[model samples]
Target: MLSSLALALSCLLIISPNTSAAPNSVPAAGQSIPLIRRAQPERTVAEWESWAKNEREALTAKYGGNIEKRSTGTNLMTNQNADSSYFGTVAIGTPPISFNVILDTGSSDLWVADQACTTGCSKVQLFNDLSSSTFHNLSEPFSIQYGSGAAVGTLGQDVVQMAGFSVPNQIFGAVTQASSGLLNPPVSGLLGLGWQSIASSKASPFWQTLASSGLWTDPVMAFQLTRFVNATNVNTEEPGGSFTMGFLNSSLYTGTIDYQALPTTPSYWILPMKSLTVQGNSITIPSGSSSYSAIDTGTTLVGGPSSIIQSIFAQIPGSQPGTGSWQGYWTYPCGTAVNVAISFGGPSWPISPADFQLTKLTSSQCVGAFFELNTGGSAPNWIIGDTFLKNVYSVFRFTPAAVGFAALSNTAVAMNGVNAPAPSPTIGSVSASATAGTGGGSNAASHRWSVSCASLVGGIVVAVGAAWM
Candidate 1:
């Protein structure tokens, strides 16, 4: 989901953070960091649907609706929790205070709870600027809204180290107050990997700063997002996979990488998607439908236009639109293998059926991974998330402004096993019916895009909160 906050807050006032110092040392290219996958306990189908609703609402607020034209904008799965986010540990300040933060490619901004955050920072580790001799306060305010909650703070600069690489004078928000929903224990903040143009803070993201400082050998970052829903053993937390900077790891993928050129003046990793197919049948996108798609690593499920999503489920037997709280969603037979794929001016990459079945709903019905989205205007119509990303090795290249995808290697595929024949109660289930539409399309209409600006500073703000959406 591209945060509407990016677009709505583009004209935010800016106070440049000092970037005078060089890194302690230039690390070699291809530095890899292991990602931690945190899974919440399994919830009922209704609970999962509710979570999905919130996720979509947050996205709607971020991208949908009539965004204020003041200025700029920009821009998981489960469990076995039905909602999992990937994290990588990064240290801020002089002596290096480490915090496990989400590696989000959706928006551009890096932030963590400040020592002064008394509102919802009690449980998580806070960044104590007083202890770090190198910390500098930019004296600029910052605030960002998320679907679950919002965080408010001030801009600050310090040394940031991750995976053996150190970037000095990195500007980030030191949150003073936040909603409890944005605070997931042990998961302190987020590291934005999107373009600087869409950054609410109007500051270079950590990765871009590292590249500009001549520390990166190739100016590329790649991800191998692992899965666990179909694993033989389920756990609350597990190894999500790898995040490599400066170079791509050949061992994680096979064959030539299919690189899709991004739009000029790109914000998110927006690209042209030629078509979408379900069970090898191409689904027709309406005439006014958006042709551009955003390869968002920060989102959980795949979201498309409402009518297009409805067309997708129509091809599956026994498929039905969600009724009450599950509106804007579709469900099908749990045992049905729904093969889906999408092309980006190259060979169509197939999505595993296991990932398509988000979670089981009943003895016979299972929720599909695709959801409906209506962004009102010409934003990217398709928002691709982990449901399709986990099947490939994704690389975000800066120079050419392109996103590359390659087939996952056997070793990478073995991390998550195939989906079981039927639903497992221990996995998760909810109460729902595959009947005629009741609260279906109407619920989606209710979400017809809106923006919620939680807080702002110096005319600039960026989301450094949770990446659960």
Candidate 2:
């Protein structure tokens, strides 16, 4: 496809042990970056729709299905320092309490320090500290992790105010062993916009909390990231974008919102597959198999059963099947012509070359780059990251909502020009991040327009405009 471009979370959890992880061993290749850069595009509502529609519903009804509906939101985009990695703070309660937070859609489980686990978890940002005069920790601290290694903390009652809404005495994550990166993001904690397990807790969560509290009649959340690439004058804190959560308000976008159904939630958006194609050619991958695919905003990369990934990679010319530790992830001759495509409960959609490129750790030589994830996984697990999200306009809904997913016309990204990866560390090995590289904090410039071309099966060469209307 492109390069072994890995989503920050995929690289971290698969590699880290604190969070539940697949066994580790020698690493293999990752996704690749696109060899060519296409002309950019001017984004509009219409174009985004075509890229993420159901062109294969009748064909893949057995694979799974898609959904779209109006939803709501609550800001979890933690405010950051204007120039540093630290998260800005807010005072709370009579004693004054402060904590860092990272806005995450991949994994859920909002952990904050609990009053009880005072020992081992000190390194982590604690919530119960009464240093701020306004701080207060409730007697109950509850913590949960879904295999992505997690720590425990007391569940206290307190109000967390951000953006607009204030979640009062909301039970959040006070994860242990992860105050600083390595399962703990640099921020004090994380927000679960991604709904795999209602984030951390399987039950009582922000959705339940809000719905129960009657703050919002419906739970709907959608993200609008800035563009990739950076611009010097950036304000990561209030620097740019904003996500809205509440019942879908038509006033948000000037375009139309598509709705899809999400019948089950073993995986939040489990849509069936119609076919698998390489360079536009149909391949013999199982489409009707009992195995289903789940769309996760929490997971940065798409992981699935070994057979599925193996088949896709095997078909790639010159690509080889990695063993032991590295599987599912793929690699091919850097210059050799490569074209990878995907099907999300519908027709095969090609994976962009940029999506394939894992990372160009080196500009001089591209050897260090990895191809998404290789082995780390055991059974059929698909974690779709930027490769997929960039291709579709995704929206998430929580609890008793009629819509399971919301489809946007386009993910028009506008970056103020800031990169999410921490600046190079000079003093010491920077504390490890739970995930590597930033998730799609910014949308691809391609949203404005796609340029350039590559020959696919039958030499059916195709090229996209830098901008689509």
Candidate 3:
């Protein structure tokens, strides 16, 4: 649960003197930025799924079991108007400015938007340090806090520029003051990739200042989000995927990539979950360190533990629990062939039941991005978002930092917007008896649902219009 929310590879590469190569030591091969998903005309897709279920009910009431909690001193959370979901495009000092951030692996700083902020950061583009000549005023001073607001600011350094590569100095955060969920943020701040011991600008965490300044030939980082699964302008913004830093693009992913090793406690990408089967039931969760498991690309859904998500729909057929602003939401009947699976030590993966349906709350019904996070008692922390990470092709390595997952890369299954198909690692060991709803008509015998964890826990605010990518 980092509060700020949130490469390099190959092709003739070799540079390890503990990094920082570029003074002519060669290296260079790493760059590619497109990552688009913009749409946020003042928030929709059910207001970004009701602000990601109100930031997972304010991180289960502010760190209850406190899983992976790291703070180094300052903390930030800024989910202001959120909605850009996944963004890209860097460029910083010496006249660069460009911006458009938000690529969080769930927290580590790299802020922006500081021409002395002025107020609610006026929708994007700022950072002017008196028109830059490689700005560097590290006058130190900071503060970040968000689930909806706060930014303050100080610290600085320059030269970042992406795609065309270049690192130069790169320390970040400039803000001046912000909040209002980052006033106009659909991207213009946030580029963390996590771990620098939970950085709040303690500095050296912009991909470890781009691999100690050598700028990347392979410290590895990869992602291929896409999935707008169009139900018409699924929010709009466009582009969708691509953001490789060091190198992994073996055409986006398929077969062998797996990687995992993260929990030496660096912060956020933490893993080791090992099991979660549904439809073949294996639910019994809630374990140590708040139940480890984090993988959050800026979280958009998929949570856990409310008694193993109410014993995973009490084990699926016509699932339920949803009413009056859909309290704790959950619904079914669209094509209910539910399967769900998760494991992190390898094999078990599976997901796709039309990616767990999440929307259609009428005209034949549907809803369910899997939320239930009552970690309030702690030791049950789980987040894994992008509704199962857009079906996979992830990879986030920093030397041996680790976090990988593959399959989904025939250009991300042809930019899924319902092109569907491609994400079948299949897994079903035991729970499968609740399937019906094959082609609509007869409204599948009028779909009525219910599954109370005491009527879906609390902070109820359901809304899954779709494409909260």
> Which tens-of-lDDT digit does each residue in 37-103 have in candidate 1?
4898989999999899778767878886542211100001122233356666777887887786777
- How do the residues 98-147 of candidate 2 rate in per-residue lDDT, one tens digit apiece? 55544444444455544445334455555554543433444443444332
TM-score, predicted candidate 2 vs. hidden true structure: 0.55
Instruction: Identify the leading candidate in terms of TM-score.
Output: 1
Q: Candidate 2 or 3, higher lDDT? A: 3
Estimate TM-scores for all models: 0.71, 0.55, 0.29
Candidate 2, residue 394: Cα displacement in angstroms equals 1.1
Model with the higher TM-score, candidate 1 or 3: 1
Question: Model 2 scores what on Cα lDDT?
Answer: 0.39
Expressed as tens digits, the lDDT of each residue in 1-469 for candidate 3 is: 4334221233224334344543435444552222345785787788899899678868976877433221111011122121225566566777676676666776666777787787777767777888889787867676654333456677777776555455556677788777544534445677677766556655556565555444455667777776563245444355456666666778767789888888765666778687788888787665556558668676556766666676788778788877665555578777677789887878778777765666676777687778665433322267676667778888778768889898785766776554222221111121111111111111111010111222222332221111121
Models sorted by TM-score, best on top: 1, 2, 3
Please name the candidate that would achieve the greatest lDDT relative to the true structure: 1
Task: Give the poorly placed runs of model 1, Cα more than 4 Å off.
Answer: 1-83, 286-289, 376-378, 417-466
